[model samples]
Target: MYKFASTASIAAPSAQLTLSGSGVFIFQIGSALGTSLNSQIVLVNGALPQCVFWLIGSSAVLGSGCKFQGILMASASIGFMDGASLVGAAYAQNAAVTLINSVITVPPACNL
Candidate 1:
């Protein structure tokens, strides 16, 4: 389990991130220069006011019961679990998006 603030950027080798309280979290899942290829995961338990995921050369998998208020950019894929809520958008280039019983308020507008 890891704790992060909304203003901070997260870059880790681990695949899973767990949020336990009410706040925002910004995650830099992959390399910004497109130099790495790795998969990332996020688990939110409470009011996640804002959450941003930036994937330059990787993918992101979101857990259930999360309230997001930012964007998700993935070079590979962006997957949402059951009961997950996204108030923003998800951009998946060169891949697809998988939503299983999830709610996305604003659909992604890809530059494809």
Candidate 2:
């Protein structure tokens, strides 16, 4: 239902984030053009746990497939509280990223 990649910034000192409320946000690489078709904020510019994230250009939030029955797409400057909430949260993935706790997963699919 959506596709694209962008370089998101989430400020400094802060280290955590929450892509909840139903959405899909990632920081792979490249501009967020032609890739943002349906997203609340197709191109996220938030901190990454231990990095500095900032709004270098736009901040009006861009997207097409944003609001829906089941779709969360945005990034927010967060802290450790958001990260701790991840613990004990159900996970699922046909693939692996790191260890058991570092894999990409959706929060309990619907709840936790």
Listed in order, each prediction's TM-score against the native is: 0.50, 0.21
Query: Cα deviation of 90 in candidate 1 (Å)?
Result: 0.4
Name the lDDT value of residue 10 in candidate 2.
Answer: 30
Error of 1 at 31 (Å): 5.9
On residues 8-69, what C-alpha lDDT tens digit does candidate 2 reach at each position? 43322322234433333333323221113222212134312212122211121222222111
Alpha carbon lDDT of residue 58, candidate 1?
A: 59
Per-structure clash totals for the candidates: 0, 16
Q: State in Å the error of residue 25, model 2.
A: 8.5
Model 2 stretches astray by more than 4 angstroms: 1-5, 15-96, 100-107
Which 10 residues in a row give candidate 2 its minimum summed lDDT?
A: 77-86
For model 1, the stretches where C-alpha displacement exceeds 4 angstroms are: 1-27, 31-53, 107-112
Against the hidden true structure, what lDDT does model 1 obtain?
A: 0.52
lDDT winner among the candidates?
1
